[model samples]
Target chain A: MIRKLCIIGVGLIGGSAARRARRFCEEIVGIDADPENLRRAETLGVIDQGCASLERGVAAADFVLIATPVGAIEPLFRALAPLWRPDCIYTDVGSTKGNVVEAALRVFGIVPPNFIPGHPIAGAERSGVEAADARLFEGKRVILTPLPESAPDALARVEAFWMHLGARVERMDVGHHDEVLAATSHLPHVLAFTLARMLGRKDEQAEIFRYAAGGFRDFTRIASSDPKMWLDICRANRGPLLELLGEYETALREVAGLVRSDDADGLYACFSEARAAREKFLKSTENNHA
Target chain B: MIRKLCIIGVGLIGGSAARRARRFCEEIVGIDADPENLRRAETLGVIDQGCASLERGVAAADFVLIATPVGAIEPLFRALAPLWRPDCIYTDVGSTKGNVVEAALRVFGIVPPNFIPGHPIAGAERSGVEAADARLFEGKRVILTPLPESAPDALARVEAFWMHLGARVERMDVGHHDEVLAATSHLPHVLAFTLARMLGRKDEQAEIFRYAAGGFRDFTRIASSDPKMWLDICRANRGPLLELLGEYETALREVAGLVRSDDADGLYACFSEARAAREKFLKSTENNHA
Candidate 1:
């Protein structure tokens, strides 16, 4: 059991971690740049104590979870470098792993043996301490991209911590994690944001939204997610996201060509393939959860 | 009360209409190219009678609703033109209005005064008679694009029919309806299908899907919709859809440029605007329902 757990950036992800980790840790401390969030976290019983100072937060903690945006993680590591404890297991819930890994290297010249970069594939559109839920990570997949220098015990402890909170953990290479996430998460968000912007800016925007059905609403729901968080993710995972966007644009152009030529058979083939693939993917995920 | 209501293409939309219309009409007749669909519609009590022949189905029916895919609407219009009755009011639930209007003109040398083109903005990923829901159109918007020659009584009757089924009816020009729907519905579906196809065909398809969370699932849910139906929509509304696709591609490229340049502020602005717009749109829709 963790003697004490420190969570930095105590918003939705951090606050949620603190809430669930309370059962497995003796003490839970939350550190937030925003004093209001820190206060809310403490009052909500999501954390046992709140600290405005990062040094005070991690003073005697055996585990530290940095749950900031990808862009802020590097500076956070720099702040933690001097007070870094070798025996403590350090991890993060950043959306992009490569950026977090790079941040650690830039901060300390190399990833410390106890600093494991991880991402939990779970979230809600709402953020802040008030939205924290103890069951946020239940049945969710948590990917840990442990560096070569990462202590074996540190990795094991991090995995066990997530599992204790009802998450399924998997290990992956940092670069691969970024690429897969770019395809599945980042690119989708970009498309959703772009689509919403395009339609929302139209002169007929009111009428356009009035006629939109459940399908359109579902397709663009991600556009309502926290913009600053998504902006950081898009910036952190730019290379893979841009590559996928290029490929997706090409595919869309091909479909447009089919429509232009009135090639019913070609259009049918493209849509049918997508439908079958999505159905198969959904079935596999259901089986995984089962 | 209507003497009889004939419904063609008795799948999800048509079957749903039949089920709900049973309360207002004396009898409901269903006609489908698929014999099994017709049989199921009758057995499920979604229709009072089933007929394989179009002529036999519409005999003595004062109201006829052609609920076929956009691709089949013209041919159905041609068939109905030969059997046209002066007193009966005819309407369709095709997705594209311009195409339906053109079909009526092409078949009868002019749009019949009694024929009204209507589209109900409600659907599900699943199709066929088995997926029919009596409440499918409840609280949904139904767009009616009545031609200049359309009989006032006929348009009023069609509007009344949809209102009786718990839908809000609005009349729009045929061309304008196509443009608005292309932006709100068709383009979103196209994007979903393209994104799903691009990621699903990847070599790491399994890994990509395994890490994808609720956002990706919700964003691509429309990709699971009936392929043939969407193919018909894309083809029938090609002009407006292509125009919107080009505009959308340009917008995507601009967002990509922001990412490539790591212009954090620009990315934040774009995403923030989208989030705010979507939230506003959602609020308006909620208010509409309220």
Candidate 2:
């Protein structure tokens, strides 16, 4: 059992981790720049104590979970470098892992053996500590990108911690994690944001949105996610995202050509293939949850 | 009250209309190309009678609702023209009004005064008679693009029919309806299909889909929609969809540049604006239901 667990940034992800860790840890501490969030986390029983100072929060904790947005990871790592504890298991729930690893290297000038980069593939459009749910990570996948310097014991402890919260644990290479996430998560967000922005900017924007059906609503639901967090992810994983975006644009052009030329066979083939792929995806995910 | 209602192409939309119209009509006759679908509709009580022959179906009907795919609307109209009833109030639930209008003009030499073109902005990824819901169009927007030749009584009757199914009816020009739907619905579907197709073709496709989270699932849910139906829509509304797609590509490039240049502020601005718009949209939709 973790003697003490400290979570940085008591937003949805951070507060959720703290809430779930309550059953596995002796005490939970939360640190946030916003006093309101810290208070809410403490009052909601998401944390045992709230701290404004990172050093104070991490003081005697045996586990530290950096659950801030991707942009804040580097600065937090820099601050934690001076208070680095080798006995503690450190992990993060950042969307992008390569950037987190780079931040660790840049901060300490050497990768910390206890620092394990992780990303919980779960979220909601809602934000803040009040939106945190103890069941947020239940049945979700938590990907850990461990570095060569990562201590085996620390990595195992982090994996066990996430499993305690009911998440399936998987290990992946940092670069591969970034690329896979760019395609699966980051790229989808970009497309959603772009579509919403484009349609929202039209002269007939109000009318357009009024007529939007259930499909449009579902297709653009990610556009309602936290912009700052998504922006950080976009910046951190620009390379893979741009590459995938280019490929997608090319595919769209081909489909457009099929539509323009009235190529029924080609259009049907493209759409059917996509539908088949999506059905397969849905079935696999359902089986996983089952 | 309508004495008899004839529904052509009794799939999800058609089946749903039949199910809801049961309360207002004395009898409902369903005509489908697929015998299995017709049998299912009959078994499910979505229709009172199932007819394989179009002539037999429309012979005694005072109301004819052509609920076929956009591609099939023209041929159906051609068949209906030879059996045209001046007393019958005819309408269709095709996706694209411009295409439907053109089809009517081509087949009947003029859009029959009783032929009102309509599109109900409500659907699910699931299709077919078995998936039809009686409440499918409840609280949904139905766009009616009535040509100048449309009889006022017929237009009013069509609007009343949709209202009876709990839909809000709005009249729009044929060209305007196509453009609005292209931005709100067609473009989003194309984006979803293209993204799914691109990622599904990847070498690490299995791994990519495995890592996809809820956002990705929701964002691409529409990709699982009926391929033939969507292909018909893409073909029928090619011009507006292509134009919007070009604009979308340019917007994506601008966002890509911001990401590549690490212009954090610009990226944040785009995402935040999109989020604001989406939130506003959610609020407006909620207010509409309220």
Question: TM-score per candidate, in order?
Answer: 0.98, 0.98
- Those runs of model 1 whose alpha carbons end farther than 4 Å from true positions after fitting are A203-206, B203-206
Candidate 1, residues B205-285: lDDT per residue as tens digits?
A: 355787888898999999999999999899889999999999998999999899889999999999999997787678768
Candidate 1 chain B: worst-modelled 10 consecutive residues by lDDT: B202-211
True contacts kept of each: 0.81, 0.79
Clashing pairs in 1: none
Residue B76 in candidate 1, Cα distance off native in Å: 1.3
The root-mean-square deviation over C-alpha atoms between each candidate and the true structure, in angstroms, is: 1.1, 1.3
lDDT (CA) per prediction? 0.89, 0.89
Cα displacement (Å) at residue B196, model 2: 0.8
Give the least accurate 10-residue stretch of model 2 chain A, judged by summed lDDT.
A203-212
lDDT of 2 by residue, B23-97 (tens): 989999999989988998999999999998999999989999988888898888778888998989999998898
Displacement of residue A66 (Cα, Å) in model 2 is 0.9
| Candidate 2 pairs with clashing backbones | none
* Candidate 1 displacement at residue A245 in angstroms: 1.5
Instruction: After the best TM-score superposition of candidate 1, give how far the Cα of residue B233 lies from its true spot, in angstroms.
Output: 0.7
**Candidate 2: C-alpha RMSD after superposition:** 1.3
